[model samples]
Target: MYGLLEVHNPENATSDIVFVHGLHGDREKTWTKNSVFWPQKLLPLDITDARIFSYGYDANIAHFWARPADNRLDTYSNDLFSQLNNRRAETPAANRPLIFVAHSLGGLVVANAMVDSASNSYQSLSSCIRGIAFIGTPHKGSAKAKWAQVGRQIIAYFGKSTNPELAKDLEEKSEKLAKIGDVFPKLLKRRNEEAKGRIELVCFFEGQPMNIGMIVDESSATLSGYESILLNGNHSEICKFGSRDEENYTKVVGHLMKWTREFENSGTTEEAKKVTNDAYFYGTNNGLQQHTNSGTMTLNFGMRN
Candidate 1:
């Protein structure tokens, strides 16, 4: 089966929201707390006019030894495209305005998916995206990644086999990670220019440290121009909301509510008609434009784990 799972699909919905989980995260469990999945139980209650889907892929870093040498971000992006296309074929509403909520390495996968969409085969899927919410995504390299590599070495020394290849991929200064950081800005610039500010970006960073230390710091989690919100949780906890009463849950829902209102007000069908297929590949040489200073907001719920 395709790794895409439909969480809440309302009949009168106007847009589509897709959630992508991070490394070692399951499609359902990643966004759940106290036996309740937020995307299904809470998000639908707030943003009623959009269908929700959670995209899953094999994100096990420990299984890197079993994967091909060429298996990397591009491979994951291709798989994402295939699953999305398969869904589109089965349901025509999949073509509606799209928004992405990605966590950790899932952000990289989404970025690569957008890049892949510039090619002929995936243009439609790329063009459908209107907004993205990045939760604790390491846009730059993270110190925790380096520590993961060291931890793997320690495991290997103790006669426990581990995937060095995957460890290297997560390392702070790894060439693979650096290349993604370099190219992603250019891709965003091109996409933003083509969309004429129609595409929106919001980043959410963790305020607390993970068990292994901070997996993604504020500097690594945020992009330069977008609005970055600091939530009161660690890397994993940032995505998990126990109930609608939590401030973290409110912030996420508020963002989506705003996006959906703007989407419907702006006229979705008309906007889609305006975008040409060549819009994806047309603006490679344009310099990145300065985004209006939307500024950053730090939401301190004062709840810590």
Candidate 2:
């Protein structure tokens, strides 16, 4: 199932939060450490009033004789957009405030998704997004990307490497990836200019280094104007937490809580509340019918008299 899954849904939820994993990362495994799934086990304890979800995709940069050649970063972003938009559309959560927490290349996908949502067709998707927090995501490029290119070449020498354009896109200074890095910030800037629901963005960088040196340096993992937090682990460990009190979890969850509360008090998502209706019939209005809607309405209907 390469789509979104609702991992946590509580009564009277105030927002919907999605988790997108990075290259070669599983939706659940990316945020789990020592067999503890933080989003399910730890996060809900702190973020009690928000629904949680995780999106999965085939993120391997280079596959040894893998499936189709159509799988690319652009394709993944579009998949995420389609899945998220359709899942929320016409549902009680359609206009609810949304937050995206992504790691590594998942951040790029989130960035591109954010930019794509600006179009008129995806206005609902754009307006619902309230905050984004990226962990060890390569906003520019990372050393691991260069390694992916090298790995591709090494596998191609054996005639087993499938052509993966996403590898090239992730390479350090690749024009395509750079374009995403460039346009993403400007899109957020435009949102600020509109003075509408300005999306809150935060970049988290890994403080330690992997055996291949730091995978993503601070300059590559962060934007200029937004807030950036430094986590106390390596690229692989920055998102993993064995307990709620871990420094990484504390810093990250603290920001998520703060943002959720801010969105609640701001009333920015008032338009997207749950779709419900009530009617009263009196006198000769026996055949009266009532219809009310919230968010992007679809064909589905439910009624109670």
Candidate 3:
């Protein structure tokens, strides 16, 4: 199976955005829906001449739930690369920048795709990936996988969910998810380190003041030489483009616009580093741009320039 895709063509555009979604998410649900889709919000920005593309993959949740976890890597990674190659081929060869806006599991796919592109292992592709905005990516492994393992054990004990796909997947992967849980800490740490310094890695984390303490500080989330911004909301609401939260949706749009323009003007690493702890309210552009109540990071586009 392949992922869904949406290409908003603008002839002779200088930049193109490729959108990727996370687990249990498809092209439309993650990028197109009016409720919280990113493309909708980004389209309204003052970007006069740009193209937007949504990259979907064969990340069928049912298959993921049924197949072994590692099996997912084998299945999805190639398609991820293939989708990017196809998109590049469709481009008009203007040597423009490509920006990836990925959510959740989509971030993982984007990373793998970049790794593949770097190796030149994928066919008919170019290393035009400029910047990335990872919204609530588990650059660290997910806590939910632990819960899923517990649920699987309970189901196994009762011999429940005996459907063939479920049964096969459980039999194949029951042991692996547990081991994955055990090694997740180190794995996540390594992933965080490996991810930094590769292009621009912008991570967006949740900070709704949950009783569970899910949000980590900016140091853990921020990458070297890249900027980070925290918003005020949970994981799900962080991606809401036009959300009433103001901090994430409204304010983020402004920051993103500023970052894009700046990146285009002077390229990366052109700004002075000034860590300011300013407070601003929602509804105002300055309030949204400089506010830090949530956990989201963005790496401005144009690394190849």
Candidate 4:
């Protein structure tokens, strides 16, 4: 997932766009599957003079999210971002603006890398970053994590460390549940203050009946300069990076087109609006459609607690 990004450079390419996938996903599977179609669909329309690239990391949904406070998984954001910067330096591409296209946990990774100085690479990379598009990312913590905590406790009582299988499973569950309540909103607050006018933040969320709203209202929300949009798709299918499905693919392309237009026309800052809703704001996209049946489905890709 690291190294030179493969892209199509039309003559006179204006800028570059970086596509970052969520947890448990990588360059090939994440946005490349369906979302990759954006550039081709919008190029003639003049949305951007951009090319697409993906970032990779070592992520395990079962363990990483369960242990949010663990420094190992948390450090991935900075480590991967550093690789991206090195790649860009090694190969000079079109001088077009740089935009970050992230999904689910990927958004959090990007947000953390941008705001936190704990990672030395963050400060330098933040300056070059222009825009950020987050799909189904929980800028704030998700209720799903809270539910996972219950499951973790159950496993702890019955399946404690005496048995390796039980112990490992229990740990995985605990780590993911803990992550749901951690990071996100806190990261957003830090990101907003650090990046300020340098980065343009846009959120595209799932608005279907089962789909939850991005940030699900400002209370859970923390990021600033966020222009959010709602779509009629489940957490699994929201951004079909490289999908052949015309309809699903188009939804993402359309949003990108609109986002590019906004970036091209307006300056860095966009008006921030107040969102309203309770904890169960958008509800959960339950049933088999969620891709994971352990419990509740995740809004961003397959990362679930």
Best by lDDT: 2
Q: List ranges where model 2 is wrong by over 4 Å.
A: 62-71, 141-173, 273-305
Least accurate 10 contiguous residues by lDDT in model 3: 268-277
Candidate 4 structure quality by residue, lDDT tens digits, 11-55: 433345777766556665554443454444433344435556666
Q: State the number of backbone clashes in model 3.
A: 13
What does candidate 1's lDDT look like per residue over 1-305, in tens digits? 23889888887777889899887788889999999899999898888888888988887554221233544667777888777777755544545788999987788788878866777488777877889999988775334454355335333432334444454444442445555567777777777776444578899998997555667778778898889999999888899998999999888878889988998777555545344111221112333222223532343444444
State the weakest 10-residue window (summed lDDT) of model 1.
276-285
What TM-score, over all chains together, does every model reach?
0.77, 0.78, 0.59, 0.58
Ranking by TM-score: 2, 1, 3, 4
Kindly report the root-mean-square deviation of model 1 from the true structure over all alpha carbons.
14.2
Better of 1 and 4 by lDDT: 1
Clash pairs detected, candidate 2: none
C-alpha RMSD of candidate 2: 6.6
Alpha carbon lDDT of residue 15, candidate 3?
64
- State in Å the error of residue 60, model 1: 1.4
Better of 1 and 3 by lDDT: 1
**Number of the candidate with higher TM-score, 1 or 3:** 1
lDDT of each: 0.72, 0.73, 0.51, 0.51
Q: Which stretches of candidate 3 lie over 4 Å from their true place?
A: 1-4, 32-38, 41-44, 60-70, 123-126, 141-198, 209-226, 243-245, 266-305
